[model samples]
Target: MFKNSPYTIYGITALILIILLIILFSYLGLNLYIISYLISINLVTFLYYGFDKLIAGFESVRIPELVLHSLALAGGSPAGLLAQKLFRHKTIKTSFQMTYWAIVILQIILILWLSF
Candidate 1:
């Protein structure tokens, strides 16, 4: 029903991520502060993506790629991926995608190292 609006995908992805996070945290007994931080960072990253998309439509000054990568590295890569897909932004840029995936991989490695 939301064929005309990209927001449907964004909302769905956010909801699913939230649910999954809750479940995973419950299973792992992770700290509340980390959960809160992830939620806040992801929200900010999603807004950044939305803002960047808006500016792109108008040919206005855009948010820097470094800033975007920083946010993703700061625990927002899942949100970044969702935003990229939902907004159809930055997905076509191979360099950006490569860097983004690298950030994701690094984060995964960090998480694994810390979990042990």
Candidate 2:
């Protein structure tokens, strides 16, 4: 049933590309602090998504999608995807998915462009 799943491919590809880029750049002036920053930002993004999912059924205010998208754009898309997969959140909204995938693709493009 998972065959032909674009999500699977996208996730796998993104992970591979990220790792490769990190390794590549680490020798070309990338510092541990930058990696730490990515890790920290990703952790925050992951927590935010989880928090939003937890409060989804409440009558209280919700975490805005814009914030989520912004987090993803700021080097947290991987964590965002992980949160979506783990918590089963934001997977059903086609518009949100579109925006998310677009952000991911943009990140990939930016990385490739900056690599050269």
| RMSD after CA superposition, every candidate | 10.3, 13.2
Estimate, for each residue in 1-116, the C-alpha lDDT of model 2 and write its tens digit.
Answer: 74545444434444555566566667667669688558756877788789889989998566678778877998899999999999999999999999999999999999999999
* Model 1 residue pairs with clashes: none
Q: Per-residue lDDT for 78 in model 1?
A: 91
Which ranges in model 1 have alpha carbons more than 4 Å from their true place? 1-31
Per-residue alpha-carbon lDDT of candidate 1 for residues 43-92, written as tens digits (9 for 90 to 100): 77888798889889786656778778877987889999999999999999
Clashing pairs in 2: none
Model 2 C-alpha lDDT versus the unseen true structure: 0.80
The alpha-carbon deviation from the true structure for residue 50 of candidate 2, after best TM-score superposition, in angstroms, is: 0.4
Residue 18 in model 2: lDDT: 53
In model 2, which runs have C-alpha deviations exceeding 4 angstroms?
A: 1-31
